[model samples]
Target: MATGTGIGTEIQISDSSDEQVILKTKMIKLDTHNWVQWSCQMENYLTARRYDDLFMPPSEETKRSSKFRQKNSSALALLWGCVSSELEGVLLDNKTSFYDTWEVLGNICGKNSIVTICETFYELISLKYKPESSLQAHIHSFQKLCARYNSITSDKVLKATFPPKLLAATFIRSLNGDKELTGLVQTLYDIKPFTPAAVISRVAIEHSRRQPNEQALFAGSSNKSMQKTKWDEQKQRNKGQRSGKKYDKPGPSDKNDSDKRMDNIKKMLEKLQASMKPQSAHLTTESNIKTVVPTLMLS
Candidate 1:
């Protein structure tokens, strides 16, 4: 039997031709969330099968053989199966060459934006282990995010000036409080050329060796509940302030002062209107007298 790794699993093929080989491989479907890793795996699989040539347009001079056509059709079907339902709709009417299909999918799924890549990198770097989750699960999540970041950034020129130890230390610092694991990670970081894989392996071993503590788990849960309670209280306080019910509620003195200001504004407007009315009356009377005096002089 020969063993080989494909995608996310190990496959063992029987040496005997008569024996049926059971292929074990995980189907990594392409979706918006996992396009990067899916594209990487598909590229690897295609390159391994020498089907990468299908990515180029067929030359006019080249005559297609029946065997080549069959293989190409089969490859297309396999590629279609790997795509998600939404992508399948996009590719439904596509009956063209594999290269055309590949290009279409690339255009649709390949974000390749520098801003998107930076956001993904930031998310990976800022990943924190949830208190409710296991150490192994958290590590797996970190690895997946790291893989995604790497796939998105594979084309970009990254700065490798930082030492491996520094990288490992940074990752350890991001992890939640696990004193024993943190100490182990520090010790591993002290050794030069500490790779992420090495740190992961050591952490896994240490995690497995340590027994589960009911008390610690309970304490973590309690802390989470306490945090949630505090958040709820803060949220309620914010709501009260927004509604002007609690923090910003008007006091008796403030209400009286506001009423006094309004009254003063009203009195000022009344006085101004009274003064304008008298001036209007005086102007009208003076105009009437001038007209009467002109009539008397004419007579």
Candidate 2:
């Protein structure tokens, strides 16, 4: 069956094998965060397989052709497989052509309105690093938000307000005062062409260094505390020994020497008393003889 020509030139399907080959090739599924990239990839895949014409309306000659309807249905089925389940429900009741469906999906997920773009831009600028979240993950999320906002907005707006320098500055300002990250951001701003990717890489490296450095510091403090405790204990033990030595009393041998000194003083006093008694006896006998001789002379 012959199909009608569309916006792109009519692709004459001469062989069934080529159709099967195109059908067999898997397409990348779309997600909310990656719609822009996914759409680009889908366009490239459709163009490469010469099936892009299926997305456009048929020409006048093929408007009533059954073969054109069959071709559109096949292309729609393939497109359905490439979308996520969340988007499937939105497009399920859509009775439009493949091109209309594609546009609808883009509008829904792409958020092409100026308000949406501005909101996304504000969110990117306001994105802050959470202590519980990973630093690298936060940086990556901000980068993706910036990319999406840039894709939606015009180059003039981006250049005037959200330039690369401003993006880098915003990212640096959102950090939660990590010294390594702050220093790296400062270095990045000092250099020419402030690239966000460089800042992300430096942040990852700094995060890795910070973990080990913090661990080492903690271990060092623990060791110092333990050493201090041991030193204090030793000082107390030495002090107790010195106190015991300073107030220590004498033993049994010292008591025996003191008793021996008291006994020697008593023996010396007894010897002097015994010698004085012999002299006293001689003087008494001499006095009695003198008294008797005086009585005889008087008679």
Candidate 3:
């Protein structure tokens, strides 16, 4: 008897053993084109829970009965939890019994209306490959759409059919938006026995082949980006060192400046020594003349 309050609806019912049976709505949620499978699963599940009686219309006497009302309430809870949000809204708006709600669902999805057929046709033609999902899933979805469209159109006044060639073509067209799968389209068309099965098989093969290549490409690009980032960081560090406030160690520019200063000092020392040599020579000449004059006087 446990239940959830809001959109994440859960209804628990007791089985013969009095164990709680949790309803998983996702497993039986009615999709746009899955009424056949959905109805089957729903019926099977409800039958297991002994609530399949709700599938039939309630008589006037049973409608007023307390036991029938209780069963109907549980059936309604299960039905509401099993349907998608869109269909849940339709059920809510009707505000009817379980049998009436079941009837409404059958009318909308069980029997193919003109509007439903046209919508399915439009969706099949306009479907594109979404990168979020795999190529295989895209192809499978296309196949399902084709099946639904054909099934619905089979009983129409002007019966429509999707041939194998058209299905293959439509699938290929759907894959056009995906860069990786687009290459296989022409190859699929060129192969003999152009059919959906052939195209799907080829696509699956190509997808498996390209998976490793894609991962390798991603790894290579990531490595290159990492290297570039490290290089940039090193460059920035060198720039900061060159412009650092503290000059504790001499850099290339500092070493160059020190060499220039040493060269200038050497040149200045050489010039001073050259000037002192000439003055010494002149003094030595003057002393020799004095000595010569004195020696001549003594003789």
Give the candidate number with the greatest TM-score: 3
Please report the candidate that would top lDDT against the real structure.
3
lDDT tens per residue, model 2, 188-240: 66655566766666777867776787789999999999999988966665566
Q: Tell me each candidate's TM-score.
A: 0.50, 0.49, 0.58
What's the candidate order when arranged by decreasing lDDT?
Answer: 3, 2, 1
The pairs that clash in candidate 3 are none
The runs of at least 3 residues in candidate 2 whose Cα sits more than 4 Å from the true structure, single-residue gaps closed, are: 1-15, 19-49, 55-58, 61-71, 79-96, 108-111, 154-161, 177-188, 211-299
| Candidate 1: segments with Cα more than 4 A from true spot | 1-26, 44-50, 92-94, 156-166, 177-202, 212-299
Query: Residues 1-299, candidate 3, lDDT per residue (tens digit)?
Result: 43455544455665444555555543446756667667666677678777777788778998898867877777776666667767877778666598887777878775557776787889999999886477767777887888778767877583877778987888888877766655666687896698888878888897788689889999999999999998896666557657853333445556675466556655654565567867564533535544544343334
Each prediction's number of clashing residue pairs: 0, 0, 0
The digit string of per-residue lDDT tens for model 1 on 190-253 reads 6545787777777787667653575678889999999999889777766664675544433343
The deviation in Å at residue 211 for candidate 2 is: 5.8
lDDT value for candidate 2? 0.62
- The 10 consecutive residues of candidate 1 with the worst lDDT sum are 9-18
Model 2 clashing-pair count: 0
